[model samples]
Target: MLVVQPRSRTVVVLAAGEGKRMKSDLPKVLHPLLGRTLVGHVLAAASAAAAEQTLVVVGHRAEQVTAHLSEIAPAALPVLQAEQHGTGHAVRLAMAAAPDATGTVVVLNGDVPLLRPETVAELIAAHESAGAAATVLTAEVADPTGLGRIVRDAVGGLERIVEERDASTEQRRIREINAGIYAFDAVRLRDALGKLTTDNDQGEEYLTDAVGLLAAAGAPVGVHVADDVTETLGCNDRVELARLRRLLADRVNEGWMRAGVSILDPATTWIDVTVDVGRDAVIDQNTQLRGATTVGAGASVGPDVTLIDTSVGPAATVLRSHAVRARVGAGASVGPYAYLRPDADLAERAKVGTFVEVKNSQLGAGAKVPHLSYVGDATIGARANIGAATIFVNYDGVRKSRTTVGEAAFVGCDSSLIAPVEIGAGAYVGAGSAVTKDVPPGALAVTRASQRVVEGWVQSRRAGTPAAEAARRAAADGEAAHHHDASGTVPGDTATD
Candidate 1:
């Protein structure tokens, strides 16, 4: 589908915050939620928003953040903010990396991970339509304790924004708080960025100072109140991360539940943005579906399972399994503890038992990989009974090989079907066997030595046991007379004969 968006805008992602409250060496933007870094979420949203250019500014752990972002968004331009600076200074560094162009420029905080592309598009549209030099995204907060307040003119237009410490008593009473998100005309934003000075109490260049500068120059400054306050929250510490995590997850989970998917416990269920579950799919508590995972209709996922980049077909049941980049077909049943690695495929009605690990293999329809087995680089045939403790040994250290078990074959317990071998249809592999060669159809492949006994061993070992004592007692009591038959002379007849 062709997505219509303002791709003319250049996005400056402010990711250079030291996040001292986070109390970690890692920049706060690199912190993960679910399985993705906080900055990753914003970058993905920006990409989805169709920004022509996305610039990332890195300060704390500059090289690490740059490397991580390059891996995530290859097209992103990383600008170095070598020293700890204020948001405006960090954004100014990123603007230097932007190419010379006149278009809408949007500023986004990397720590605000839950923003929607449509919301960002709206912010840009407001900035363009108002013909403003700058537009600040603001929202009403119940407790505006640590946030900046948007001070408006008499006509309710954005005059200037005051930081908490710099705000007067009149400004403190204002419920509308600055969300630290802004969009501006490319030229005007640059003009204001150059004029920003470190004249505040902290001697840090405050972007809120630019709102006043633009207004004093007779350039229009617009105030935009965001409809969703939770989306604009910036994480500062672990406590705020936890709070924002709950908020973001609750919103995402609620949308999924409203779309016909059943999330049994919203508080315990975690899902990523790329995950797609079909109607009638039920996600149990503590289940995490991440990274482009798709669950089919009527499928039941775990109370404690994680699936990454996996596809589950209709009517499948996966419990307590960690399936990564795998596929489970319709009617399949996976384990209470199964591990299906990349390239694993379970055909219709296939069973992967507890503690089984299947990788780079295909289990055919009705095939069962029962408890405690590892089937790797193999193809299991239809209706096969893979006995307990059976494994397909497919590796010879350097190179891996394939093992194919034919239809309806029964591999006995504790057997190993070494790779480059096959079990023909209806074959029987004996217990404790290790078949390194092919077994013909309907044949029994017994790979163990025939039974043998050492002579007089039983007599040597049974001399002092309870059975020996009972035998001696019976012999002394005339056991022959004691062996009387039941009321007939059958014993005597047999003995005499």
Candidate 2:
């Protein structure tokens, strides 16, 4: 068991390659994997290992990479590799910029996002215990094609690393491959890097050359084989990027499942690495929790939901909703179909029901906007009820205003509350009304056209030629029947006589 102090180590991430195979203008290291850039994940691993300082070498699209690093990991120092050379050149630039020059230096590839921090720690531990000038992280993959092979001595010590193009027939048969990660003694690594040459087949200074150089100088070079070969996988194109994203997503979901979060369908649920979910929260199928979302205990989300930077309080239920930068309080209920935009906050036991869209508004405790409504830039007080098809018209042509519904206010169906108006506490708004003015407390507000009745209108329109003739015939028949009855004669019986 070997331990390396965090303060005695520096990490150098090689990210200067121009990933031309990706067929896009964005730098390969900037390509996103599972909601985070490729290099961002590598930086996270370095941080997790508690390195004293991490240096990132940037070349292609240096400005973009540097800008992103500032946002995510500002503590990390960014060094520019002005030349688009090999990995060796990138590491040299990073090492030059690193503050702890006498400490151990661990070099990692930025495109390998799945490499675990624990593995990095293990590599450093091996390097320290063996007292080796260089320790390479190796993996035994099924396929050795297009990868550098690790050549070991007869005594099973790492002798040298040979790239696929330079390897002999027998050397290519070796299954163990270099994973492009190394832990090196700072002083010895600097010496080897100084003597590196571009005389190889590729005519580029190779990092693997340093490993051989250290070995040739009678310095012990150790090899640490990775347990999981997939961790060594690197993204070169869009296809590989997708593969890595899926693998990382699976890893994140499995961790949550083990921590008491119920994911009904792991395959259909996508959660970002930055998301936090409390125990007993059930995430249903087709849910994507992205960008710093936090779900409290006993919360039920999805069946079809996408929440970005949203917070769900304990015991809240959000179903079939899309929310961004919203907050649903404890015991609140939202959606079978709802959209909650930025700054929309729902208080405890509040309900935003089907077909409702809330933006930049607050729904107080026990308030209900049940269906077919849009509440924007407004506030609904406690116990307020906004009826179906109601809309708070908060936007005029040039500017946006707000509407306030006081506590216990009742807004009727199909009504519009024009902006800059307030409905007082316990106020009643009639159905089909378009309210434009504020109403006093406990007052009834109705702004609809008065109704006017037209008496005998149907009869006047029906007094036509055919209608009058029919009425005259009916009157004659009735009089004849009355005469027969007064004479005590049955009209139908008189025919028999």
Candidate 3:
């Protein structure tokens, strides 16, 4: 017996709108929400739904959108729409790119960042089950303002979709609104799109008209009602975009919490969809974890921290710090106020204490840089200790260099280890020293002027002042004490030594 294989799926994203309401030089679809561009979220859902191919229609600063797509979704092809026609025209351009598309063709609006993959999957299931020529995703909203209303027939079948501008008072009263997501039979969609014309109130080719056209021609049209109305929300401006962000953040945080991650304050903590949190991790308040960041199991991050493209190993603790493109090994601790720039790597059991800044440096296991210090372009070996106020002077006038601290080295407080130098294993660097040359193994390196005493200088230089008066009285008391000692008697002549 022979078995048949499933049909292929194609996703078409309509992103050509100029989005004048956004009021920014960047393309509307390129605007970021929850650490991802609006269109990027839609593409993610499409990919999750297992689309064999994805086509994004771009216009109005197409170059910028295409460039961003290359970085985020390289596999998804982009097709340019030279003119701002309408949703129908945008889909037409996408179809032109995939003229041989078969099976299910899903259409998604680029601005609906809250759309979920399960909803798209449900829409496809409903369309295939009903053998529908076209199916529109619908939701029952509290207020249907600025949206298209779903009109039903006597038997509760989809009759038509009426835009807000074209809807009558009775049609506007309908609570079921169109979500601008659809699944269609490829052949039927191609025919219906070719039949569309600019006859609507906006004098543009409206995609909703295809639903009415198919229903009128006796083609089976269906409706898939989404369980959650929030999934259908779209943004036209920054205010709506922020609302979407809050909703998305809540969703993301809840998922992590359910998976055993502890979020102290969900309201103040923002986790991007791209971020991964291992089980049993703790995320404190006022923290934003963004852009491919990963936290290993048993990690503790922040009461106030932001990590971007960074990795926190298991059992590590990062507090009140900011890190980007860095890595912290297991059992390491970073900051009450630390900044780890790109290429900063900490080995296991390492410590980067308060007010420290590290850039392009590597700390070996058990190495520590405590208190106020700056370590740049340096490598610290295992068991080495860097004292307070120590700075690795890595850059000179015309060039930058690196400093290396050997294993078990001890750097004293208030020291500056100039780059192009090396402190050998077991070497000791004295306090207030400025090391300019390499030190041999087990040797001591100290650079400072010899001590010099300048007694009574303040008394002679600042006469008739507080210092001079205090010095004069101290000298008189010393002279009297000396006489009393010689006589072996007290000042009051009561007792002898």
Give the winner by TM-score: 3
Indicate the residue-level lDDT of 368 in model 2. Answer: 98
TM-score, model 3 to reference: 0.94
Q: Tens-digit lDDT track for model 2 on 250-317?
A: 99999999999999999999999889999999999999999989999999999999999999999999
* TM-score-sorted candidate list, best first: 3, 2, 1
Model 2 spans with C-alpha error above 4 angstroms: 1-4, 452-497
Local lDDT at 170 for model 3: 96
| Candidate 1, number of clashes | 0
Looking at model 1, report the run of 10 residues with the lowest lDDT sum: 483-492
Question: What's the distance in Å from true for residue 280, model 2?
Answer: 0.9
**What tens digits encode model 1's per-residue C-alpha lDDT throughout 215-301?**
989898888778888878889999999998888789889998899999999999999877889999999999999987999999999
Error of 3 at 192 (Å): 0.9
Displacement of residue 51 (Cα, Å) in model 3 is 2.4
RMSD of each: 4.4, 6.6, 3.4
RMSD of 3: 3.4
Model 2 lowest lDDT segment of ten: 1-10
Task: Note the residue pairs that clash in candidate 2.
Answer: none
Each candidate's TM vs. the true structure? 0.89, 0.90, 0.94
Q: Which ranges of candidate 3 are over 4 A from the true structure?
A: 1-6, 462-497
Best by lDDT: 3
Model 2 TM-score, 2 decimals: 0.90
Which residue pairs in candidate 3 collide? none
